[model samples]
Target chain A: MLLQILNIVGIVAFAASGALVGVRKQLDVFGICVVGATTGIGGGILRDLLLGVHPPDSLSKWPNITASVATSLVVFFAHPVLDRIWSAVVLFDALGMGLFAAGGATVALQHGSGALGGVLIGATAAIGGGVIRDMLVNEVPLLLQRDLYALPALLGALLVVVCESIDLPQGISLIAGTAAATGLRCLALWQRWQLPRARVKD
Target chain B: MLLQILNIVGIVAFAASGALVGVRKQLDVFGICVVGATTGIGGGILRDLLLGVHPPDSLSKWPNITASVATSLVVFFAHPVLDRIWSAVVLFDALGMGLFAAGGATVALQHGSGALGGVLIGATAAIGGGVIRDMLVNEVPLLLQRDLYALPALLGALLVVVCESIDLPQGISLIAGTAAATGLRCLALWQRWQLPRARVKD
Candidate 1:
């Protein structure tokens, strides 16, 4: 039940980001839909493909696709109203990051991926959508920039793994991961947190 | 030798098309390179992935990548000059279609794909680069248009498949396939060929 909720939130957040990027890029309705769909599902597609899961969930699952498309349309027609609810957008995105992070690690674990592999997969799943979104929009990936972006997902996945090792309930681990990721992302945004940059050589 | 030559020619042609689209989209040098690279190699990547081939050839075969990047740089600096060489571009592109069609079919057959699958793969391999390029530029895929974009590759694959059934030499079959595809493409271009469009219900 919790996973399902998080999945919906992630789809909505991803679609919203995709629509915003499409609007910023001055793309039309079709373009907006493409970006939204790609952003919402790109990471999971990559993960599933790498795991040798044929067709991928994004293609096989109707609800995920519907959610992505619906979110894009909503954003397309009502971005001004949605923009007024910026906190809601951030909250949705943070929820998505945590959900994807946990989902990725869980899937990788099911595939018999090692702890390190799970961590990597979780991180990839969390950020893969955003990377594809930025690429489609012809912008440098937000992942390449150092912020709270990938780190939050990493910590969330790590927490999930740790809790699993100690025999904690999966639901609790998932919720804890979501909360950690959300809090970190909110803090990062509020504080304008950035990673240290390398000094220019003379 | 001929397949290798065709591959190089196809990569260059696709690269040129990618560069042209990038120019139209007002992308920077990096963006142009991305478009060129994806256009030159995206189909092969998809094919390899579906075939469960790890890392994909484009990642491991640096020469093919070099060909794409070099072609992109050339197009970037010499757009004006290359624009005047339209006939040469078309001719090279035709040769590329012929070569890649055969190559895609051969690879699929090696992987035990059925005759129909081989044909589909061949057609996809031939036009995949252009499809990706169009998507990246936020345009509808050129292959989906009324142009005879995918037909030459289909014919080429058909010839190869027919020859294989008749116990013909592989070399001869490849040559025959290339000739068929090239002739069809050239004829289509000369005749200003187009597929019939559906009537719109107003």
Candidate 2:
């Protein structure tokens, strides 16, 4: 029941984030929904594909699709209201990322994916959506940018793997992983942390 | 034996096209290989995922991976020579696209995908790779642009569907589909065909 709730909220939050980007880029309503849905479920789709899940859970679940589409519609119409609560939305987005990373790692581990595959698939699930969204708009993905986005997700995945290695309780690991990733992301946002870049002329 | 030959050639041709794009972007050798391999096998991977084929054929097949990587290395070293025969490369790329489209449709049909599913999956196979390569490089995918790329692929897929509905020989359908798609693409190149776009002032 708790996992179901988190899935719904994560889908909505990610859909809202993609909808915001689509609106900023001046996409049509259909285009906005496409981007929003892709962002909401694309990662899970990739993870499922890699792990050999047929039909993919996200694609087969009507409620998940409906939630993402409805959230995109709400975002499209409620931009002015959303603007006021932008910080809260950002927080939710961070929480969504943490949940996805940890959740993906747990899924892969349960599927008998190796330790390396668990962490890699976990990170892929966290950032794949945003990378795809940026690609659609012809912008550099924040993953390769200075943002400390990927690192937190990786840390969360790695932590989950560690828990599994030590036979720790699944619930304990999941909660801790989410907290670790979300905390690091919020701190980076607050401190304006950035990775160093090479000083080469393009 | 003939199908194997075509698969090898198709992978190499697509890899070369991707490698050329990576070269123009001035990516490192590793990055170039990554882009090339994605372009070569990404479409197949997407098609397999959509069709619920586990372990995607591209990932499991070592020869396919080796061939694409070797072709990327060749493109990286022999770019100047490749530039002189760029027209030839474009021709082969078109042929590869056609083969992938028709071949993908046949596979889907065999898998019991309906007529619509077959065509859509086939087009997905034809364009999925380039979309992914562009995504990795942070470029707008060519599919959304004015290029006459997707229509020909769709046409090929449609032809395959038609043949299947009429119970035609597989060999005839495959050849006819490939010829139609490649012919249209070549003609478009010669005439510089483009899709009309909405002119909204940004």
Candidate 3:
């Protein structure tokens, strides 16, 4: 039940982000919906594909589709209201990222992926939707260029793996993992932390 | 046997195209290889996921990876030589598109997809890789903006559906479908055929 609630929250947050980008890009209604749906479920789809799970959970479960579509419509119609609360949106996005990273790691581990594989898959799940959304808008993915984004997800996934390895209870491990990711992301934002970039000669 | 050979040919062509793009983008060796592999197999991966086929064929088969990596390396080192034969590359790309479209439609039908579903999946398989490659390099997919690119693949997929509906022999249907796509693509190139676009007001 908790997992389901978290998943819905993440889907709504991600879908809103995608819709915002679509509106900014002046995409058609169809394009906006496409981007929103992709952002909401693209990561889960990627994780499932990597784990060789066919007919991904997102497609099989009707609720996910509903949540994403509903969020898209809301964003399309209420951009004026939603756009003003940019900080709130960012907070929700960070929370969603943390939840997704933990969820993805758990799924990967359940499917027999190793610790490293779990971490990679988790990070991919956390960031894959954003990457796809950015690509649709013809922008570089923030995951690739932004500092401290992928790292938090990776660390969160690693925490799950370590906790599981030590036979910790599932619920507790999940909460801890999610908290670690969310906290780290918030800290990075507050500190304006950035990853180093290579210096190229002009 | 024939399908395997066709798949390899398509992989090589797509990989080369991806590598060429990476080189043009001035990406490093790792980025070049990443783009080449994504372009070579991303379509098949998408098709398989949609069809509920897990652990896509490309990941299971070593040859696909080898072909993409080898092509990436060759393009990185011998770009000047490859660049001089642009016509040859274009021809091979057209052939690959035809084969992949036909193959994707066949797979979808075999997996119990309806005619419309087959057509959609087929075109996706033919064009998904290039879309992904372009996105990785932060460019809008030509599939969306370019007129003739996706049309040929869609028509080829439709042909496959039509042929199977009439109970045409499998071999004949595949051949005819592939030929239709390849011929149309080549003609489009020769005649500079284009689809109409919406004119924006200045």
Runs in model 2 with CA error above 4 Å? A84-92, A165-169, A195-202, B1-42, B49-130, B133-138, B142-202
Query: What is each predicted model's overall lDDT from 0 to 1?
Result: 0.72, 0.77, 0.78
**What DockQ, on C-alphas, does every prediction get?**
0.08, 0.14, 0.15
Model 2, residue B67: C-alpha shift (Å): 17
lDDT of 3 at A124: 86
Residue runs of model 3 more than 4 Å from their true location after superposition = A59-61, A85-89, A195-202, B1-42, B49-106, B112-127, B136-138, B142-202
lDDT of 1 at A109: 70
Q: Name every residue pair that clashes in candidate 1.
A: none
lDDT of 3 by residue, A1-202 (tens): 7667777787887887777666666554545665677788878878887887755667556778678878877777777655344455457567778888888898899899999998899888888888877787787776766578888989988898899999998887788888999899989989999877889999
Candidate 3 similarity to native, TM-score: 0.62
Tens digits of per-residue lDDT, candidate 1, B137-183, equal 77655444325656788889878877877888778777887788878
**Alpha carbon deviation, residue B138, candidate 3 (Å):** 4.6
Interface RMSD of each: 10.4, 6.3, 6.8
Ten residues in a row with the worst lDDT in model 1 chain B?
B193-202
In terms of docking quality, how is candidate 2 classified?
Answer: incorrect
Clashing pairs in 2: none
How many clashes show up per model?
Answer: 0, 0, 0
